[model samples]
Target: MAEADAFIFAALQQSGMLEASFQGSSWSVSALTSDAFIAIVFQFLTQLQTSDDNVTFTLPSTLTNTPVGVAARHRVGSKLANILKELGYAGDCGYNHFLYPSEKETRNILSCFLSPQAAEAEDDKFAIIQPQSFLANTLPDVPLSLESVSPGIAGGDVTSGDIIMESVGSSGVATKNVAGEENFMQTQLSEETEEQALEQVQKQVDDTEHRIAAMRKVLDRERGELQQVEQHVLETQTTGQEMQKQLARQKQLITMLPQAQANIAKLESIFQKNAEKKAEIAQQMESARDPLLKEYAQLESQKSNRKARCRQLIREMKTFRSDMLELTGVIHSKMESVRALERIHERQLAKLDKKKDCQDEGPMTRNMYTARIMDIIKQVHKQKQDITKILDDIKGLQKQMNVASEKLKRTEAVAEDKLYTAASKSKTSNSGKSEAYVECYRKFAQVRELFEELIVLVGDVGKKENIARDLQNWISQLEARDSSSHLDKVLADLESVRHENGTLQNELRACSA
Candidate 1:
């Protein structure tokens, strides 16, 4: 019996419902009174029954003369009745005696605890029990009873003094029993302890309610934050879709880059060929200009020399004509003088003939007259010869002057023809050179334009290559992150972009054509 009490006490202590103390070769629990202990046991049994209907825990069969044991059993019966009522089991649950009945009396006692209606209900419906309610019921108050005194002992015959002693002793014994029972049911019997316990229980209940309310508030706040996060995710998805479209267009441009590069290379080759032809033509023009310039310089020098020589010849001819005129004037004057002399001599001769006929003079006078006359005749003849010679010389000089003037005119005409031919040849060569230079300039302009276009295209190609490199690095990073499935989708997108680029290229070719 002591072992059984000790086991129950230990179990209560372990559950934190009782505090044990050593007292004179025995252990006492002060945290729970007998009634509260019984209530705790009943609650534990109720939980066990609800948890598993097939299992049952039997209480110990020990009985004691102490009021605590009896009060405990009565408290258990009351708790069982309350449980049955809460479970909706109708009908009365019988007396406390059935709580620890003997094995032989178990069947009969079980019927006393469970009414027919309760037994029937127990098979189908089970009640949910709350932990707060269990805690409240586990320590219920129990009233002490003094009605179990034996009537036969009270009626026993005795003397006056003996009766007085017996009365004193009985009063003392009752006081002792009450004090012992008070210790076992402290929280229920004492007003101050019961109030303190109630206050403590109320405080615990209040604290639990506050904690639960705080948890609920936290949960609501978290729910609102989660909703906001969901909205942000939706917006992000929309922006990502727009970015994907832009990327698709960029990919298409990248796909056409190689073909554009090939076309640029072909154009550059043609430009190179044109440049080579221009250079060759320029060299040929330079080579051809050398001899033509030399010949032109020589012709210019010859023309200047001829002009100077013709001018000098003209001055010399004019001087000679002036000299000849002066000489002819002197000759004419001399002839006039000679003519006078001849006339004088003829008159004289006439006079002499007349004298000779008139008188025959002496031989000496006749010879003197004849001699003077002959001398005069000779002088007149010489003067005539001199005048004729002078006239002849003047005629010869005039003829020479005419010949020289004619030669000068012919030389000037020939020189003018040579100059004209040289000028015509120089003009033809200049025209050819100008045509070649014009053609070269046109070709150079075309080549310069092509080069500028190529530079632009190359810049565009470089930009595309940089984009492609960035994309490759991005794909590599995704692969490193173990997103190969997404890589496959990206590759498919690339192929589609390439196809679109090919179509665009075809359209461009048609437009250019």
Candidate 2:
């Protein structure tokens, strides 16, 4: 663990992420707070985005050159996470870790930038950090031809030692400077991230298992081919021995020597062809076996990755399970409180029954009552205002959640497209047809998601269809029932209206006269 810490600390220093004042012994994951972590990531990723065209980031609107609020900080963190994901960062890059960094998660994240090789390299020894760590040993093979004029100053054991010692010095600086309380940083993944990570790890395990199986299959095929070749060679040897015996028996004949010579020549030609076929088989075996071996090696490396991930997940699960146990304890305590409150309520009821109070338990003056009433009214108004403000905040948060969810979805889609799909040009210009192929991986993923959504929607649709049919049938029955009664009532009302109109007109005429 110390070695790992040393490695991580050394890397941070080498990459200039950690300052010169930061010492290796003092360096720990606690120093990276939510804001601090986001700032560092933003700085690194912004620089990365500038250098690489492929690396794009979706900046939070509220984020200025300096981010202020927690939400803005989180958005910035998520942006960094998206960028890291797009860049194919291996371990957990979720914003939760940025908000609450763990030693393992922080180290994994730092390694992404300082030692990209850490992911693909078969061993830590093969990482770039290892080379720099052993600069004293490796510098001897270096030629000072570029600085031939000042070879003495340009390259030597002293310079190499300094180069090695510099890392040591940076790590030392980190030790003295990196002081922070360990309690502040939650040294595990958060609750939401845990499920995502478990799924991701399961997928990786399945992939590695599948790859290892395929490699084994290729090796088996190679072994079978090799066995067949050996059997064929054995048969050839037996046939040649028989032919030799036949030629030896016919040696008395004058034509036998020529015949033997002819047989020998034919045998030589056969051997030559056999040799060529053997060479071809060997080449084929070499080609096939090498890739399988490489794949096996890669899988072996991934085995370590999967192990580390599994351990991390186990740790996260353990922490969460403990929290769950604590929650149960809290729930039991609350139940006890509820029972106590019930007893207290019963005692209060008994007291109320025993103690009879006088009617005038209030202030003597009406002015006092008025003042009290006004105070109550003011307090009610204040409470109402507070409620409204709280509701407004809730609405704002809901909007933010919706917007962030949509943004993350769109960003992931674009990131996937950028990371995986390369635009291919047709080989019709003299190259090749570029393999007749159809890749609908992304499309299929979308369709799968659509079908899953449709599954839920179809049930709702069926229910709605039944409801509509019932409503339509009910409405049709209503329309078929009461029309004649309604028409008779309407005719009676029209007759009454005509009589009233005639009376009103005659009254008007008499008034005019």
Q: Top lDDT: which candidate number?
A: 2
* Tens digit of per-residue lDDT, candidate 2, span 1-513: 667667877766655666445654777665656655665676666656666687556545453454666776577667778878887887877778876778778767776675763443456446546654465366554335334536676565566446546876898787756543332243334554787899999999999999999999999999999999999999999999999988877765655565887878878999999999999999999999998999999997985675455445434534543553454355445544544654465466445433422333332343434564686577568656855765675566556545644554554455334323321332233334333211433543564376448546745765775687579658756865866744754465456666666998999999999
C-alpha root-mean-square deviation, each candidate: 62.6, 42.0
- Per-residue alpha-carbon lDDT of candidate 1 for residues 1-513, written as tens digits (9 for 90 to 100): 455445544544444434334223364333234444344445455545666676544433342222355666575566555654554444544334235433323222223333343444565554556644653475232111113435574466753336545766899999999998878787556878778899999999999999999999999999999999999999999999999999998997787687997868977999999999999999999999999999999998987787576556545544544554455455446545655665565577557655753454322343444675686688668767866876686577557646754664465445444444445655678865455445544554464466458547755765775687579668755755885644654465456666666998999999999
Question: Ten consecutive residues with minimal summed lDDT in candidate 1?
Answer: 139-148
User: Model 2 Cα displacement at 143 (Å)?
Assistant: 18
Q: List the residue pairs that clash in candidate 2.
A: 22-173, 22-174, 23-173, 23-174, 23-175, 24-171, 24-174, 24-175, 25-175, 26-175
For model 2, where is the 10-residue window of minimal lDDT? Answer: 418-427
Candidate 1 positional error at 96, Å? 99
TM-score of each: 0.23, 0.25
lDDT of 2: 0.62
